[model samples]
Target: MNAAVLRQIDPGMPAHPNELDRKRIERALGSRQRYRYVSPKVSCVTGGYHIESPCCSRNIDADGGVIDVALLHHDAASATWQVFRKDHRTGAWELHGVHQRLGSVTDVLNADPERVFWQ
Candidate 1:
């Protein structure tokens, strides 16, 4: 991972998504029935968040026991969100899609048209 891309949010600064956006993200993920049993965990980063879930696959050991579901970053200049799915083999994030709203990103994760995020 690039050092710039891994920047951590400053402790004194306000959270990247703020409370309202956080609530929206939580609600979006909550609405998915699949998440009810194995809820995804969300963590704040400098520009956005990382969504991860518990690993139960035979390859779980290789993934450190958790699977990275998605990465969402806000592009302030364009006011849009960039979505990324983990390339588990390489432990890198690959751009999946981009959307104008956070809800749209969650929708794509839920629909998983290409079987990217869920896998």
Candidate 2:
């Protein structure tokens, strides 16, 4: 295969979050007060984390599967965290906020002032 073809086929792996940052992110999400009752689950992804909670609304899904809550990615180059909210209808991740510290991102998720992430 040509170089271009190889590049297209394998775009290369995403930058992995360092252990310290990863642990901090996980702790922030796991200890969210709003989700304490729900017991949110946090999974490490290529460059960030995926958070989900058990579905409670039958109208949304009859199976009661977990629902996407939020996504947080670390941008090593920028030294910042990017927060995203899932659009349930379109299944697309929309950028919500960005912060330099994990605690700031946690505050946004906890407050959810606009009902974006928690909703």
Candidate 3:
């Protein structure tokens, strides 16, 4: 994915996806961490290590690009997604176990596919 597109999609670097209804876990003295991801398949993606730890940290490009979904994983202990930060600092998201793939999304079946099929 293009870096420019990534910047445009995640202008604020929000911890979770705007559409995710989940209320991520929170820890004391820290802001709550949340996870958001796009699920076209509507079920748990359980086959690839890359899915478990996406280096670019999934991002979407509603405007037009190579991505169309983004997810945020929260670290309950630190109360923030260490993965996104780690990717920013190093200019790359590592393949460590910390970049674990998130669970399945329950609201996907009910999602509004307005722009999805139009493309």
For candidate 2, lDDT tens digit of each residue in 1-119? 54345547866734444455556666676655454556676778878888888766533456777889888898978979899999988999999988998789888888776767765
User: Estimated TM-score per prediction?
Assistant: 0.74, 0.72, 0.19
1-119 in candidate 1: lDDT tens per residue? 43233335444443365655655676688766343566777887778988888764435354546688888999877878999999878988999888998878888877775657665
| Candidate 3 to native Cα RMSD, angstroms | 17.6
Best by TM-score: 1
The per-residue C-alpha lDDT of model 2 at residue 3 equals: 36
Query: RMSD to native for every prediction?
Result: 7.5, 8.0, 17.6
Instruction: For candidate 1, give the lDDT of residue 90.
Output: 90
User: TM-score for model 3?
Assistant: 0.19
Error of 2 at 5 (Å): 37
What is the lDDT of every predicted structure here?
0.73, 0.74, 0.28
Give residue 93's error in model 1 in angstroms.
Answer: 0.6
Shift in Å, residue 8, candidate 2: 32
